[model samples]
Target chain A: MASNTQDAAHGAAESAPGMPQLDFSTFGNQIFWLAIALVAIYLILSRVALPRIAAVLAERQGTITNDLAAAEDLKAKAVEAEDAYNKALADARAEAQRIAAETRAEIQVGLDEAIAKADEQIAAKAAESEKAIGEIKAGALESVKVVAADTAEALVTALGGKADAKAVAAAVADRMKG
Target chain B: MEGDIAQLGQFIGAGLAAIGSGAAAIGVGHVAGNFLAGALRNPSAAAGQTATLFIGIAFAEALGIFSFLVALLLMFAV
Candidate 1:
């Protein structure tokens, strides 16, 4: 078995001087080229590509924070607006109530003034009517006294009795008094 | 006859080295597929993970290149 392996190794070594890449003379060149390529790739990625990516990430973060802050500001503004509206509504209600009370007081004063004027007019009319009634009653009583004196004098003369006018008038005045 | 046997041995060794290259291909595929899956799930974080994905690809591809080199060496070198 050992002889067979040796034969195989010898034959393979003799065949075409083996792989050119495996040649010791070219190893240094291959290693140098590989190192150059790796370094170039590393430098390009770390310095250029990686920094740009980092910048984009930072920019996106800034935009998100700004948007959130703006939203918070808008929320605060909305709350303030609601509070202002509520205050205005309350003020309007109070003003309306004040106007209503003022209007009610003015109306009540006008009604009282009107009622007092009407009562004064009615009292003046009643006093004038009572004075007229008293004057009519006095005139009627004087007419009745004169009519009774004339009737008594006429009755005595028709009976052919002597009726003095002065005596008859005095008797009528005394009877009226009784 | 000895020369023929040696050539046959070299060819067989080269073929065996090709298996290593194929395994490296599977490793690269795994790395890339996992990165894509993660990237799709969180697009905002995708950029952050890209460097790691490239590094994984580079390591896997290096293994494949080494395997190819080994295959070449087996076929031609002692």
Candidate 2:
């Protein structure tokens, strides 16, 4: 059997003119196997692997879109928050300004009232002082007149002249009138 | 022998065809490297450009596969 196989192999090597792949006898087998493998691969890819890959790709795309949408939503929320914060800050400033203005107005009113009250007290005190000065002056004038009459009567009697009380009183009265 | 010389020629031709496949590999590398560089620079646009990158790779790989086919044809068919 080995010798026969060797002879057959030797005959094949002598008869074959070119590469084995070009041999017409094996062409059908090679072509058949190649077609089968190619078709099988095509079927597996189209029916199974490709659809799975496409599903994964779609899922990835959906995830990316969702993430982008979420990011956009977050950004809008942040912008709204910033706007609200700014509005609140502005409102707080306005309120503070209003309070400051109100406080300033109240202080101004109180200052004006205090100044008016002080002025009224000063005017009353000045009037009271003026009336006291007028009374002191009138009392001083009456005492001076009485002392002058008594001095004139004493002088007339000491001079050894006719010292009549009625006459001295009349003379002192006329001098005091002038 | 003439047959021995022909077989040597076929092998040598196949080896030479392999060089073309190697050159196609360099082209594929260039395409892929450039795509990676561009993608890294603009990550936000990377998704939009991924299909184009894959197409470029496939075209470059097709040339390599053609060279491989030529090598196989040289070694076996012709």
Candidate 3:
């Protein structure tokens, strides 16, 4: 075994000088080119593209915020308008109620005055009727006295006794008085 | 002269790799910062655009990784 190992070692050393070694010499060049590419890409992004994009985004945000604020303001105004409309409606209702109450009072006063006037007119008509009835009664009484005296004179003539008109009238008045 | 040239080449290669990495990092930071700022502004768009942002970052990172690989190859393989 030892003699075989010695022979193998001698043969390997003879072959070693003739065999080519694996080469890895171009890695530096590859790295240098890659580095140059990386630096160039970085410079383009940082210097050329990012700032414009950022500015556009900022402008968009500003517009959104402004729109939101305007919407909020409009909402507030709408609420205020609603409140004002309600208040105005209430005020108008109150004014209408007030006017209605005043009109009712005026109507009531007019009705009361008209009723009072009618009552006065009725009282006056009743008094005039009473006066006319009194005058009629007086006239009827005078006619009744005249009829009674004529009846007495006719009755005396039928009996063939003369009746003095003035005496008969005085006797009838005295009888009625008694 | 040969020794001086080798030293200069090594120095230049290392410097370029370092500069590449540094520049890549700054670029990645800018991309990430802008992405975050945009996401904050429009959260709804963030999810939809996140994949694209990541892709851009990966591309930029690949450049740096490639530079590192080249440096390693120069030192060890070449």
- Top candidate on DockQ is 1
User: Could you estimate the TM-score for every candidate?
Assistant: 0.38, 0.47, 0.42
| Fraction of the native A-B contacts that model 3 recovers | 0.00
Q: Identify the CAPRI category of the predicted complex in candidate 1.
A: incorrect
Model 1 has fnat of 0.44
Strongest candidate by lDDT:
1
- Clashing residue pairs in all predictions, respectively, total 0, 0, 3
Candidate 2, residues B1-76: lDDT per residue as tens digits? 2245665676678898899889988998999899989989998998998899889989998988888878877655
Better of 2 and 3 by lDDT: 2
TM-score for predicted model 1 compared with the true structure: 0.38
State the lDDT of candidate 3 residue by residue for A1-40, as single tens digits. Answer: 4455344334434554212232335557777999999999
CAPRI class assigned to model 2: incorrect
- The weakest ten consecutive residues by lDDT in model 1 chain B span B1-10
- Measured with DockQ on alpha carbons, how good is candidate 2? 0.19
* Model 3 ranges with Cα > 4 A deviation: A1-38, A130-178, B1-78
* Model number with the top TM-score: 2
Candidates 1 and 3, the one with greater DockQ: 1
TM-score of chain A of each: 0.46, 0.58, 0.53
Candidate 1 chain A, poorest ten consecutive residues by summed lDDT: A8-17
